[model samples]
Target: MYKIITDGSCDLSTERAQELDVLVVPFYVSTDGINHQKEIVELGIRDFYQFMIDNPKVFPKTSMPSIQDYLDVFGPLAKDGIDIICICITTKFSGSYNSAMNAKNMLTDEFPDVKIEVIDATVNTVLQGMLVEEAVAYKQMGATFEETVAYINKIKISGRIFFTIGGMDYLVHGGRVGKLSGIAAGALGIKPLILLKEGEIFNNGLTRGRKKSKQKIVEQIINIS
Candidate 1:
């Protein structure tokens, strides 16, 4: 049997992961100088979002999982003679992909009989979750490792994501947007449209209000459809 692995950034719930037999590697999130390992099995989505709402001044800092983290999960599975398909967030956003690659390379010599394929999912959150689900479906259908990877590559380019943040402070603090742009947008009650394209995040457009932003997102979806 093949095992599907993903990082916590996929926004998958513990129950869903269990149902699909997918393994999730935890990433680190720091809030107000305190570091917490974000494992969906331990932390619910509501609680995490509530913490973000409560700590407006302190933007949570997220760190990619280390190579050791990947090994901790891949080693035992490799030893068990189970193949693995690891889907990681976009390389542009995190080093998790590279870390997984490093782990795969190191384990190759020790576990030459096992096969591991690491994919740069080039997406995160719900979008990433959808990709993981698709991979799980392919696995369930008994597709070979090569077939699954090819299917993922074919569909990965077809997905597009658009989102609006509640506030710009976090974006500014993260250096995702210019400080002046954030300040100006806040003053004008404008919301910027952030899109994930090809593996990179871009601030492509702006809307005058939340309603307009939602409408713009809907229009884009309709157009894509």
Candidate 2:
């Protein structure tokens, strides 16, 4: 059987995660000087999101799961004689992809019998989740681990992501945008319609306000499709 894995950055919920029978290697959520790399299933999404909202200043920072974390999940499956395929967020988004790859290589030395493959979906959020969801269904239908990984690669190449940030604070803080751009945008209340292309976010354009920004998103999607 094929065992699937992803990290918290994918934003997959517990119920959906369980239904898919995928292992989530969580990323760290450090806030208020506390740090944890626990499972998202354990943290609870509603409460976590609420915590972020309640303490807006305490922006949660995420980090890749440690190598031991990957070993813990992969070891059990290796013992069970299952092949592993870990679909990860874009390396461009986080270092998680490289971490998983390095861990998988080390595990192979210990469990030569178990096959481990890692695919960088080159996407994040719902777009990444959609590929993972499809991979789960394919595995359920008896697709070999290699086959599912190949399918995910195909989907990744065509993935479409459109996003509207309520504010550019996160992007600016993350260094995804220039300080001047963020300040200018805030001054004009500009909403940028962004698309993730080739593992980097590019501004599709900007709009005057929230309503127009949303409408512009709709228009862009229509034109693309």
Steric clashes per prediction: 0, 0
Provide TM-scores for the models: 0.95, 0.93
Candidate 1 segments whose C-alpha is farther than 4 A from its true place? none
lDDT of 2 by residue, 10-74 (tens): 78898889888888888776664576636484576667789878876667776778888888888
Residue 215 lDDT in candidate 2: 90
Local error of candidate 2 at residue 39 (angstroms): 5.1
- Indicate the residue-level lDDT of 82 in model 2: 89
Candidate 2 backbone clash number: 0
lDDT of 1 by residue, 100-174 (tens): 999999999999989999999888888988999999898788898889989998899987898877678988898
TM-score of 2: 0.93
Among all candidates shown, the one with the greatest TM-score: 1
Candidate 1 residue 102 C-alpha distance from true site, Å: 0.9
Q: Which candidate wins on lDDT?
A: 1
Q: What local lDDT score does residue 143 receive in model 1, on the 0 to 100 scale?
A: 91
